[model samples]
Target: MSARHAASPGRRDEGRAQPAGGGDGEYTTYYGRPVVKAPPWEVDIPAYMFAGGLAAGSSLLAAGGDLTGRPALRRAGRLTAAGALGFSMVALIHDLGRPERFLNMLRTMKLTSPMSVGTWILSLYGGPAGLAAASEVARWAGLRRGPFRLLAALDRPAGVAAGLTAPPVAAYTAVLLADTATPSWHESYRELPFVFCGSAAAAAGGAAMILAPADQAGPARRLAVGGAVAEVAAEQRMERSMGLTAEPLHHGKAGKLMTAAKYLTAGGAALSLLAGRSRVAAVTAGAALLAGSACTRLGIFEAGIASAEDPKYTVVPQRERLRRGQPVRYEG
Candidate 1:
């Protein structure tokens, strides 16, 4: 037999393959082949994720502002949510290669499929968000007496509707990622939803703080602080709990981004306390929070890709699981 096809007596014992070739038992994959493929998503998918979460958070801010007599914040939140949702849809469609593919996904919903659930959540959140945003534009144009009257009248109700749907929109993407085989994302499933939701709230609050009059941004400041705390704490816990699967998140380009996100988020939250008294502080806090939220998405996305690129990350985890007698079934 040729060298590549040659078989050795030492290759097996008792009908079981021996340790891989000549390497240490630490490596599990044959010839460095990854056991699991990385997700095919591009930059567009992460952008879609970030935008969708921002939209959901903005909707919540809008609802809070409307009910509390903060007109500037209400307008800012409504406009931001609608704009972010639009960007999110565009990114998703671009990634899918056509708008029709998205429309087709709505034909039927599958409770067991994360994609199905996410599609419906986006659809349900889109309409009300759009109308609420249009109301801001109508008010800006002073069009209450025109055909825009209907949209204007429905503003508060539509804002409330969008708020109701916001939590699902912010969280479903994490579920979708976790349902995949990517080691980092899959391992961090328990904490990913909280991270995303908190990141969303922080982004939305930052945007409102930047646009709304500083004096009217008390709720935005509170949201920013609360969200930043939750996001940072969740990420810390996730990294600690994921063990081996989290190495990529702590020692690469992804690691730097995650570190920056933590500092910016925490710093922004602290600054927001003083935002109520200083416009400069409010703008700085808002910018920091938005950057932090974006970094979180990028960091997580990069970590999943990095983990998938290395066969050892995939193989080692499964081997350890098997060695420990843990259940190891992955759907895909």
Candidate 2:
């Protein structure tokens, strides 16, 4: 009897579990396939994408707030940055196999690991951004006297630091995914940065619209439109570049989500263009853009996970490398 038959509850007379390639050759679940080894990439990558977008958006919001003389946006931007920094730290630590060694990340600064670079960026940016945001809070609380005045003095410099790091925060997550073993991520690197940039801008615009009065949100509406155009263009370029491999973006749940996001983003952008002229339009478009940004992030995450789940993506590329007599490096 086969091992499988022997282990079966009532099949004593059946045969041993035949090897996979036996006459009944078919792929079977590995070792009865308990669902333990779910893809690690999905969890970490999504968190990274969200956190990065939040950071970039917060930075832009702070800068925009300063330019437009909107204290509420400045405060919102700071708080958002602080929250994103905290969440990112949690996600990174959680994703580590040895969560205790999370502190080891600070031991050496390596340029090669995008994770390391990201860690530094978060660490460097978080402090000043938080401080700047806190200053706004202090002023509101009537605590901007004595030593608190030093914090107020530092606010401008901190805001500048946050703004400068914003674009890099948006772009670095793409590098993080690109450096991984996933075929879709690696292939889409060029466009991923632009995609992230758009998402960040949309997020910032949404926050501005929600927090600031309509007149003060005019610049944010413009930013959202610009971001949407860039995102659409980059996605198109990425789809074209991948040719057949880009099927994931056009089929399945990933495809559906991305399509919805595209429509929402385009609609939102169009509305935002005219939103500046009307408070109602601005609010509606801002809400839509926010929803669109969330969908895009979710779609990107799901597509990457799907790409990793299939053996074809992993095996075919390795086979090609072997056929070419090149060393095959396995990525997980």
lDDT of each: 0.87, 0.71
Candidate 1 lDDT by residue in tens digits, 40-72: 999998899999999999999999999999998
Model 1: residues with Cα > 4 Å off, grouped in runs: 1-28, 330-332
Error of 2 at 118 (Å): 1.0
Best by lDDT: 1
Candidate of highest TM-score? 1
Q: Which pairs of residues collide in model 2?
A: 1-15, 1-16, 2-15, 2-16, 2-17, 3-16, 3-17
* lDDT score of residue 37 within candidate 2: 26
Model 2: lDDT equals 0.71
